[model samples]
Target: MELTPPEFTDYDTRLGAYAVIVRDDHVLLALWDEPEVPILMWSLPGGGVELDETPAEGAVREVREETGYDVELTGLLGVETFVMAPEKRFARVGDRPQKNVQVVYEATVTGGELTHEVGGSTSEARWIPLAEVPALERIGLIRKFIG
Candidate 1:
């Protein structure tokens, strides 16, 4: 038998991550402030998956940590991939080339009050109507999820 490398090969393709969150016509967004980049940008309630956690578990944990709201995963919404440049500054890392594979899920608010958790990336959390999402400065993937 002949040996060959996989047809598709890339660092991002090999080790991609996912995040799942919910949108109820209006989405709860976290306003982030970064010194190097634009301030007061909205983002979804989820984040990257940890090594020992499933995508769903990471989603729930991220949402709870960022927005202070517990959520129940209902179904998968979609998967999205994006190429992030290294030179570009991110909230977590000042500058890094990061490729993201986000697996979004439909979720429902299960428990907990809507309050910002301390020591989180987000400064504030608010439920913004989907109609108003376009006007707000947000990530492209988040907009897609809301849509």
Candidate 2:
């Protein structure tokens, strides 16, 4: 039997906000354990920014949801973007290419304790040391911005 790869014909853009929160040389990250996708990744604590809310607000909300931390953004860490093929997406369906526009910022944890998310894209959250991050499996964004 002969087979061919599916042709990518659709395109979409997603706006996400992320925070780089460092404390005692460790970075706060979320474990993305979506069942549909086979790859497990550790990424910054953040997610899609809703239409009505600003990116900053989304960052705070996502951080709280994924990492159980209340954070205050300290400064902008510049914008980053990438085009992901269908098979590589974490949240979006695997049908077409997705352009991810990410707004990253520096933040500080103000309240809440370290806790894992229950029923979300991420299953666990942790504060991984900077020196140990390289050994763990991470998403592309982590390499670009963090380490």
**Candidate 2 regions off by >4 Å?**
1-10, 86-96
What TM-score does prediction 1 earn? Answer: 0.76
TM-score winner: 2
Error of 2 at 33 (Å): 0.7
Residue-wise C-alpha lDDT for candidate 2, range 6-83, written one tens digit per residue? 786578889999999999999999999889767898999999999999999999999999999999999999899889
Error of 1 at 101 (Å): 1.2
Choose the strongest candidate by lDDT.
Answer: 2
The all-Cα superposition gives candidate 1 an RMSD in Å to the true structure of: 4.4
Candidate 1's residue-wise lDDT over 42-99, tens digit each? 8777766888888888888888887788888888878787776756525345444567
lDDT per model vs. reference: 0.71, 0.91
Which ranges of candidate 1 are over 4 A from the true structure?
1-24, 89-96
